[model samples]
Target: MPLCHLLQFVTSVVSCSPAELKLDNNGKKEKVKGFNVILKDTILFPEGGGQPDDHGTIEDLPVVRVLRQGAEAVHFISSALEEGREVQLKVDWERRFDHMQQHSGQHLITALADKMFGYKTTSWELGRQRSSIELDTASVKPGEMEALEDAVNNRIRDHVPVNVRLLSIDDPDVEKVRSRGLPDDHAGPIRIIDIEGIDTNMCCGTHVSNLSHLQVIKILGTEKGKKNKTNLIFIAGNRVLKYAEKSYNTEKLLTSLLKTGPDEHVDAVDKLQKTVKRLQKSNLTILRDMAVLIAQNFKSQPARGDFFSLHNKDGDNEFMNIIANEIGFQDTIIFLTVGEEKGAGLFLLAGPENVITELGPRVVELLQGKGAGKNGRFQGKANSLAKRAEVEALLQKHSCRRAAGEE
Candidate 1:
């Protein structure tokens, strides 16, 4: 039987000892305390060759991770089994098969891309949702993407056999195959994946024996990568079905909300976006006019208050600035707030330079905000507007004291 299918193995434990394993999860290095178990033989494939580690059980104890340390496949498990004791190993076939499909699909795409477009895959990733191959070219045209997809799917339908060969470094055939060089601590026979008449490449990742097992390959599309490179995204096997189901559900939801068919959904969304933009333009015009009128009314008041203050729930920093600009701060202190009545928002304070400088930090502390200012104007994001009344009182008290001092 092929080694990949040897999920059930009765092997003696070579060693089992307490150890701390550091693993990079989502760009974060995390330390896991476990026992490193080396078996006489292992079916679990360690993370390498752009493929992830296999998840399985070691004597019914869950193997958290498997890593290749030179020639040894070390298994990390929560508990330890006695050294030299024989134990049964089981592989999570579902996870293993998914990885196989993605890895093999990647090979098919990479090979065809190089053959058809002369775009060599510089690197590839088997992501959780989809896989991507970074092509050395600056861009891939839409027509080329379509043709590549057709070619890969054709190979899948052809039921081409995927053969694995173990060759020594000195073997003449090793020179014929595509290689990216071996690891620094590599040893023993080098494994090569041959896609019948399609291509042969040096790789250590597990693959499906037949191309037909891939079921289908869907080239989702491409995205701009680093300079002179493009990332071609794709999904294969069950992932294609899952993606289709999710997309259909989203379409149905959009259809219900949009009251239109899938074909008209894009047009409907575009029309709504244009309308929103027009309304936003009109709203801005109205806010500017209103800011001027508000200042005029405050100045025309029969008995003007000690300080002027206003809060607009639907306003923003620009609106507050417009109001402050209209109401000059020569002899008046203006406290303008734009946001929710008693929640987070923005605050603007403009008055004498010395007064604003003295009050800016205190206001920021009260509202749990951070801001900077020069001259006389101070503005910032206000996290808590619940203290707006207290801020107004402080401004009024200081204004009163300043007025008395001037008198």
Candidate 2:
């Protein structure tokens, strides 16, 4: 037998202290209006099994929250209550009731899927907004999924009583309990949740007393996973109503924006994507034509090797590089403008390799730019056109000195 089964057997027979219900006044004790009780024992498993803790009033002192520290259960309370004082604890019935409904509903669905289709629930996550369960199955056909949903809902409508029992591990029917998995060291008597003639599993989480509490169970979607695994997203009870409301509003907004019905939104978006692509292509063609015209105008100007200019409205960096390569100069000074505005500029000042080696840093400092090359190329943004001229004059003066062989 498993260690947990042995532990469960021992735990069942042993009469331990009634699970200590901590008052939620930050561990501080205070006076209470009406609170008294000596519980023989409790089945409320303080928050565990991916489910949140139970909330309610203990001895009329509102239990804001219940948390487990090690093996002891601590209840966080708003009102101060004396410690060691007996209190009649009352769980938040609505919340606890809802959880019970959802949990039992989950069991019915998982059991039906396993019995009918041989799918096993491998993992599950109960989140605040939604919940999901991963099943160890390759795929679930649409018809099968619909059938499973209908079957689970039918069980809920049947209003089956959900029975909670403490049973010894050595009990004759222990092996008959068809649970997906049980705790490794489960000892003493295990807490078993059984739905008459439908499902039975060992679980420590609180559950609804009856199936009727679970009003509905709706499968939202499914995603394929590794090997033979698939995740199913679902909502239960009031969550189903909330999801429907949100989805309806979203689709209504999309229909208005696309000037089409909710069903036509996808087609509207596809058409919009094609329109954007066509506009981008047309814009590119216009930019290419403008670049050609600018290059022709620059070629008309006389080149003294002192200054080279090309005005571009599109701020095309590729065009600047093309013009620079064509107008080669031993001592070149290139000044390209981004249209008539003060945008970006590139300056290339190169003398013979030998000349630049000595005065490269000095030229960079004078132009308020920084770069390194054996020849010379300095590219950066300029504040204004006047600053460009000052840089050009400085480069021109330096080039003249080099031409005269005066270092």
Candidate 3:
């Protein structure tokens, strides 16, 4: 059987050397001047038991991954160590401790969730930023969530011992364990993690010696997961502090933008949205009336067989449609109306068939934009509004040439 690389059994000094590494895609050992080394044993836990492998350095080369194959633990590396030579191994203590705290906290939370609400954890993922466990239920109510959190935190604050006991399959203690069950293949020894006066469960993942190391457990939220399960997202230890800091910074930014304290931000945003909606309605009324006046002005002017233009920053497709339809209803005059609102530019042209045919492509080409229309009307979006002035100038010049030709 492969030796379990437990932190409790190994020290910083090891007699291991470059043991074995996986090959690259080309069916040969990578020549990238790196060693695939494993210790005679390791303090770094191989990825298993729903927890990730421990990250650290062996003989000064960074360990990429510690994977288990059959009965042996394999540690992939960035570079190789001398074969059969002694080396130093260092586990990233901060990372290890963080995993320990999270794994232990999960055990406590999972136990209490079952005991109090009968919600069994179906599965769990140990993530770097946040960890999550899927509970075997379709829905998790807010009150149930609060109760679970309170119960879990109550255990953590109690500073109870989290002891590990190794036992055979036939051990009486195995029956006492609150376990999902043993694997179908069956194993040699089962490592049972027992939380004092709480629960005992079979787990291979590392854990804190005590619950106080958990520091704190925060249930971020939950979502419906696969097969009608509820995925509970959580963070523990320093991660909770980091998450709190990020949330605080985001709220502070919202406070600045809304000009309100965090407590009043919702009300302020609601009022701001209502105010904006009213202003938009008022602006649309003014622009529609202006479009009417402009159409009348162009109608009152002497017929100029050239394209005229109107610009409105606040105009929309509907407003442009009203303006274009209003003026061209009476004369053979071709006009260009443009608006650049919210950094998007739009244009419309209508008039004599020849003018629309000639000017449409010229306008689109000038802006390097996209447009398509037929029967004396064409419009399209520009790549950007920055080139609107250049496109409009080209329209003016084209219209002048067409007028000259007509003369």
Q: After aligning candidate 3 to the native by TM-score, how far in Å is the CA of 353 from where it should be? A: 8.3
lDDT of 3 by residue, 290-366 (tens): 87787778778886444667667767667777767877723354444455532557777666666677777877776
- Tell me which residue pairs clash in candidate 3: 34-79, 34-80, 35-79, 35-80
Give me candidate 1's TM-score against the actual structure. 0.87
Error of 1 at 406 (Å): 11
Top-down TM-score ranking: 1, 3, 2
Name the weakest run of 10 consecutive residues (lDDT summed) in model 1: 1-10
**1-407, model 2: which lDDT tens digit per residue?**
32211111101111212233444377697543322222333333467666777666555655555555444555555454444444455556656655665676677878898887888888676766677788898788768888888888888899988888888878877678866566564445778889888888878776767777678999877888767799877778877887899999999898888989987899999999999999978876776666666545666677654555555555555556556555554555555555444433444444455655655565456545555665444344443443555555665677677567786
Q: How accurate locally is residue 99 in candidate 1, as Cα lDDT from 0 to 100?
A: 92
Error of 2 at 45 (Å): 5.5
Candidate ranking (lDDT, best to worst): 1, 3, 2
How many backbone overlaps does candidate 1 show?
A: 0
lDDT of each: 0.91, 0.63, 0.75
Write one digit per residue (lDDT tens) for candidate 1, span 1-407: 66776678788999999999887899999998889999998889998989999999977999889999998899999987898898999999888989999999999999999989899999999998999999999998769999999999999999999999999999999999997789998989999999999989999998999999999999999999998899999999989999999999999999999999999999999999999999999998888888889888888888785578999888878888877777788678899998888889999999888989999999999999888887899999999999999999999999999879963
Cα displacement (angstroms), candidate 2, residue 313, comes to: 14
Q: Pick the candidate with the highest TM-score.
A: 1
Model 2 misplacement above 4 A: 1-47, 52-70, 74-98, 184-188, 280-407
